[model samples]
Target: MSGAAIALEGVARTFPGGAQAVRPCALVVPQGEILGLLGPSGCGKTTLLRLIAGLERPDPGGRVLFDGRDVTRLPVEARHVGMVFQSYALFPNMTVAGNVGYGLRVRGVRRAEIAARVEEVLALCDASALASRRVDQLSGGQRQRVALARAVAVRPRVLLLDEPLSALDAALRERLRDELATLLRRFAITAVFVTHDQAEALAIADRVAVMRAGRIVQADTPRALYAAPADAWVARFVGGAADLGGVVSDGSLLLPGGRLPAPGPHAPRARFLVRPGGLDLADRSEATLVGAVTRATFLGDRLRVEIDGAAEGALVVDAAPDAAAAPGARVGLRLRPGGLIVVPEAEEAP
Candidate 1:
């Protein structure tokens, strides 16, 4: 099925007691694009999804549009959208085929057509072999497939997934993430999925919207977002980057150990952000910073070395497995070009 473009204009949500869950925000998802709403718990990612699905109404002057048509006031049934919750929500008494065919039946579609569509979606989701099994008898992965098949059986204009893979174990979730991405691409449906896992969001979505406190901090492709985060919070949240507290002086970041060249001219009090991969071991004569190795961990293909006295606190670095570094060993650190990012220091929360 073809996808539809979704647009939200000035959308906001508030609880009955006047607690605002979502601040007014505008967003757009192009047709056939899978946009990942990524954030921590209570960041309003799910609330934004519910607003799009018509499960929750927006505040006054907010509007939702699909394919340039207004759908702001439509109920879930009339919106023609598909949704998959984290729980799967499959009926215990239903067979796989029965669950897949439920939506078509609700629409009063002809039985023969419903059967054909059910077969097609089951095949698409690689669940054809499980058609005869009861919902209670299927595995977590199989159940997830059945849920997705049911959602798509109605040929929805848009698909919304709320942590669809969260119900499975870690190994199973990792394996199914690739499969889910392939299935979404095959269907070519406009989809929005909410996820707290940074790797999951980066792996599956064409674009990611990083939300915080009910606001979108940055929206960009996975590579761009990782390469250049919008701020210190985004750098830490998206890439686990370390914040190096320092002052900028003469185009260099003055740290406790030594100075590293800064990106561009900024205020003297600007803090800096650096990814773990940005620091590398170098000879003492050529090093930009110096610190003592506090810990070294073997992570299959690489070594993670933790250093002390680098900046305000300890800093971690991704190093080669063959590097001869150990705990309590002194090492010189070189900041690669484009490695140090100047970011505004986080404001103190009132």
Candidate 2:
């Protein structure tokens, strides 16, 4: 089914007792694009999704549009949006085919047409063989596919998923993530999914909107978001970059261990984000920092080395597996050019 473009203008959500769950936000989902709402729990990603789905009403002055048509007042049933939840909410009494055709049947569709559509969607989701299986008899992955087929069987204008892979184990989640990406593309449906897992969002979404507290802090393609975050929190949350405090002077940043070349002039005291891969063991003569290795762990393809007496306390680095540095060994660290991300330091509280 072709997808519809969705737009949210100044949408906000506030629950009873004066708790604001989502601040005023504006977003747009291109036709047939898969956008991911990413953030920690309590960050209002789900609330935003509910608003778009008409499961919850937004505060005043908010508008939701589908292909430029205002849908702010539309109820969930009237909006023609399909949704998949983390629970795989299927009817235990129904067979896989029954579950997939439930929406069509509820709308008084012809029996033969419903059957054909169910078979079509089941095949699309790679569940054609399980059409007659009972819900309880299916595996977790099978159940997930069934849920997806059911959501898409109705030819929804847009699809929404809330933590679709959160219930699966790590290995299964990884496997399903790739499958889900492929399915979303195959369906060519405008879809929005909520996820707290950064890897899942980055892997499955065409663009990711990173939320914080009650607002969307930044939204961009996965590669752009990883390469250049909007600020310190985005950097830390998106990729777990460590903030190393330092002083900027004469185009150099002076840290506890040593100084590295900086970009433009900034405040005397500044904070810099260093990704784990930014630091590497180098010859002493060309080193930018020196420290004693406190821990070394082999991570299959690479070695994770933690060092003390570096920037402030322990600094972690991803090194080549064959590097000789071990626990208690002193090593020189080379800072890769353009790896240091300067971010605004937090304001001091009065």
Candidate 3:
């Protein structure tokens, strides 16, 4: 499927009650690239996706363009954008092939053409073997595949997905998330997806536009967004980064665990964020700080330890899976230099 570039210029949305759902924003989505609209609930990510899909119009003076063609006033059908809802929204009574070909059939496409397109889409979505299965008999992942196949059957200019993987169980969601990314790449379709799942957005999107309180705070590649969030809130929300609560004085942080060099020039009380993996288990002699282990979970890959007395709140640290640190145990923390995320000191918010 060919992709279309999307541009939003000063786009804003207000409901009947004058509730500002989305603030004025400008964004550009390159052709064939996947952009993730990521934020918590009521953050306007969904509304933003709806505006792009033509389900909601931007307030006056706001313009939406597709490939430089004005499309702000176009209806949903006229825009030719595909959508995959959280529910999958498959027709339970119909067979997988029927659901996949429904849009083409309604558009007066010939039976042969519909069959050809259905077969092609089925193969692309890895649902070919289940072509004859009824939608009701399919699993959550299977239904998702059918929904994707149906969405792409008509060859849309852009594909919009709203929490596409939220319905499945944790394991299935993880597996299908990878499959979805691969499928989109194989189909070569431009896509904009809404997800509160940070890992999902980071793993799949070419770039992520992080929204907060109806405004876009930052938009960048996953690595950049995680490594260098625009603010403390963004840093916490994107990758579960925790604030290394301390007072900066004499070019170092006076953390309860120990003093560490805060390299940049700043006020005596500048704040910072660090990833869970950034801090390591250490001995008192080499420790950046010391804390009591409040909780510990050992997965095959790593041991996730939550510690107290390290910062103002619980600080999660990811250590080697084989490392043993049970709850109620004391652990030393070693902070890595590269893991420190520095933010501007002036704009302070809890």
TM agreement with the true structure for every prediction: 0.95, 0.94, 0.92
Please write out the lDDT profile of model 3 over residues 18-135, one tens digit for every residue.
9888999999999998999999999999999999999999999999999999999999889989899889889877899999999898889999999999999999998899999988
List, residue by residue over 1-350, the lDDT tens digit for candidate 1.
47799999999999899878788999999999999999998999999999999999999999999999999989999999999989989988889999999999999999999899999999999999999899999999999999999999999999999998999999999999999999999989999999999999999999999998888888999988898787888898987889888777777778898978885767545668888888898887888788899999999899999998878878989999988788998889998777776666666221
Candidate 3, which ten residues in sequence have the lowest lDDT sum? 341-350
Off by over 4 Å in 2: 265-270, 344-350
Candidate 2 residue pairs that clash: none
- Residue 39, model 2: Cα distance from true site in angstroms: 0.5
Tell me how candidate 3 scores on lDDT: 0.89
Superposed model 1: Cα runs more than 4 Å off: 266-270, 344-350
Can you tell me which runs of candidate 3 are displaced by over 4 Å?
A: 265-270, 324-329, 346-350
**Cα deviation of 143, candidate 1, in Å:** 1.0
- Give me the overall lDDT of model 2: 0.90
For each predicted model, how many residue pairs clash, with residues at least 3 apart or on different chains?
0, 0, 1
